[model samples]
Target: MNQWLLYGVLALLPLAALSGFLMGRKHRKGKQDNRLSSDYIKGLNYLLNEQPDKAVDTFIDLLKVDTDTVETHLALGNLFRKRGEVDRSIRLHQNLIARPQLSSRDRNSALFQLGLDYNAVGMYDRSEKLFKELLSDPVHKNESLVQLLNIHQLTRDWDDATKIAEELQSSLGVEQSKPIAHFYCELAAQKRQDGDIKAALSNVKKALTINPDSVRASLLQGDIHLQQKSYKQAIKSYQRILQQDIAFLPEALPNIAEAYSNIKDNSGYRSFLNKSLDAGAGVSVLVELSKIIQAEKDDRAAAELIGNFLKERPSLKGLQRLITLHIEHAQDSAKPSLQLLDDIVEKLISKKPRYACHNCGFETKAIYWQCPSCKEWSSVKPIKGIEGE
Candidate 1:
């Protein structure tokens, strides 16, 4: 649960306690002043005197575990945890679990809540142990697996995360293929960084097997092959991405063109660029094609093509390209002014984010398969607009 939701629960705790007290008013009160024990009064006094530690202890002692008060206590414990009072939540939940009169269901609930409290406090080992213990209970099996998966992800324990996610999928029928693929891709990336190319490829293959259309897997496969100087194989792997998602064509285009250049396949690269542009890929295709025109044809031809493209769809990147082409071809008398314009455009383009999260609107210069802000897979993509595309 998010801190905001916990704040609401905390706000409602007093009301929940009041309601519970009112509902259980006639039950074993024995005229004990609405069940506010002497210890509770003492705890309130300690709190008023600014002795929080003593107050917390006295309050815990004053809490009488009963059927009617269970929800109230749980709400308050959760509230404290959300308010960053994790120690209090821990003590409350722990004390509630230690009660011999608690029903089996309430006991399990307390355990789960306590696990969440531990997680909130960065006691991951304790949280993981509690969640693992919950796997035997059908009531919290899915939730426990999910929390364990979260903990493994936070620790970058991709192997453990994959195993827990697989169990979650099989046991709870939750959709996990996307994250599972990402986990394999993460493993592949780690192996690649460790200079274990073969192991990296093995993990990439596993990612594709789990999610055949995973763009990140294909990109990683192409990248590794390119790094190994397998230019033709790399081009083939990158070309396969067109069948998956066209939004990522720009991601593979530059690498594929570079691989083709290594193999002296300029015509093939140019031809593929034309095909992709004709299929309405993005401004990246237009920019690459314009570069080819400037090199093989002339600056005027390239400028004309880009100017016409801009007329149809004005883009910050395309305008920058146009300005750069002008600066390259300008006469000596006009060179300084055109170069200044190009610098301004470059600065503008650099300041604008190239990628953004569709889920959370988080913008950044680089691409991410999962949104860092929202932790959602396939939600961050290349920004599409006049400034980005």
Candidate 2:
């Protein structure tokens, strides 16, 4: 709800009560002498003028904190949280929690809200305990479990996260395969980094079993295979990523090429890139193919390949690479001009973003499986266009 509208409603509550109180006095005593606080009067005027921003704070300050004003207090605390004033929200909810007279429902509501406040401020341990406490109440259980999952994820407590995800799936009937798969993948990455290859591959297999389309799981499996010099398995794993999501095909290119070359199968790599290009992967595929052509054929052949691809896609990176190749092999008389153009294109390509979030339009120089700003999973992908691939 709009803050102003919420404030406007809060402003009306006291006014409505006061107005009824005055009318009762008039009916009983027949006088126009009923009094209200000056702040209350000013706040009512502000609300009448649609300036509830000024009215809400002024009115809530003058109102006594009691059962009568609990709703207003909660609304104000929510507003504070929305505005990122987490400390203020925490204090308000804590005060509400301390009120012995509060009903059971209201107390639980305040406790749940305070848990969120703690979560917002990076007190994951506190929030985790608080959410665990709320898990017995059906009203707060699902949301608290979700919050606990987020906290576990933030803390990299994969064991705890896996347990909660499975429980949520069974008890709450919530589908958790994606998150469960990611949790296993996270475990795989950690184990792989620790050189526990057996455990890492085991986790990778579990992730893939849970979510067959998990690109991260496939990528991890491919990386593990490549590290083990299992070229055929690595190539198969990398190829699976293209089937899972072609948007991430670029991420697999370098590893796939290396695996092919490790096995003396450059032609296979070349064939894969061409097939991917025919299916519309992007400029990275073209660039890699051109590099392969240059290695196998000549500078002129590579340049012509890039030239044709750029003619269709018109990428600054592709153009820059083409110019770099020319400058590398250009005649001495023409080197300086080509060098200037290459430098210009290089700067332009450097300034361009290489990845963007499909959900939020957040741009970045590098790919991210989870968007930093939006916290969305698998939303940031390698950008596709002339300037990106």
Candidate 3:
């Protein structure tokens, strides 16, 4: 819908309901019913003719403040807020709140809608007060708690968010474990940045307790272990990711290899990569495995492995790695042409994005546990295609 049209519809809603109410009250008296119906028809005619401004003016003049129209006014204000016309919605809702005749329930509802209007326009302080007020009202406790959770998330107040999430889970029966784990992960990240590794590890473990399959928690644990130079523990953490979610295999490979290298276990690293490849992992795993093969065995074996994998899962990264292997072993006659091909493949692979979000189709050159565009956890994974792996 056109934005203006949506606003116009919201503006006319209360007037339409008021007209109906007036018509119903006058039905027993049988007085001037035709006039009320005529006014409504004219307003609708203006809307149909695309004269939304005139329709809004007509509706505003026709609507009157009364109990019968309070719900209609609240509904209209909420519609405006949903359409992003926060100023108009706030005006309508605030007007409703000021009316002395409004019932306690209706008043609270208007306040809640006005709070949402403030939130929509980024007025967090004002929205926070209104939500806090609503939180005290038994009728709006659950909804208020949820909105407070959103506000806490926006402000990055993980502690407050965790508290409200727990309340929402218990009071409203809404599962919040996943989001709660994300909150702990955020706390862990903050602690890690502050050099409080012990506190960071504790928070990460709490995240895992909330969500055992949380890739973010595992990643953080591995990073902490790597920082402490606990190579075996880091290797264990990175390897756990594969069993938790195979889509994260690409993220674990480089870190896993580093941990193994630190422990001087080239043979163990090579075995791990081979196992990942045999499990039909993506081209990223295959490429890493091929590199290990080239380092340990020979260029020919690496090239052959890449060629066979490319037949099963064609990818630019795999092809680029294969070209590099061929270029290394090419004779004087074939060296220049192979080098040129290798350069072309390298350019192609470098230009392609390494990861993409399945939920939002957001592409990125680097891996992210949370999608940068959609802010969804574990959504961005290795991009697999002709120009990616």
Score each candidate by Cα lDDT. Answer: 0.85, 0.83, 0.81
Provide TM-scores for the models: 0.88, 0.79, 0.81
- Measured by TM-score, the strongest candidate is 1
lDDT of 2 by residue, 261-295 (tens): 89998788999999888887777788898888998
**Model 3, span 130-210: residue lDDT tens:** 998988899988889988988998899998989999999999898888889989999999999999999999999999999
What residue runs in model 3 are displaced by over 4 Å at the alpha carbon? Answer: 1-62, 136-139, 331-337, 372-375, 385-388
Between candidates 2 and 3, name the one with more favorable TM-score.
3
Clashes of each: 0, 1, 0
Pick the winner on lDDT between candidates 2 and 3. Answer: 2
Clashes of 1: 0
lDDT of 1 by residue, 1-389 (tens): 46654554454445434643543564555545545555555655654555556755655555568887788789878877877889889989998999999999899999999999989988899999999999999999999999999999998899999999999999989899999999999999999999999999999999999998899999999999999999988987887777777678898887988899999989999998888877767788889999899899999999998999899888888998898888866799999988888889889988999888988899999998888899998888887879877
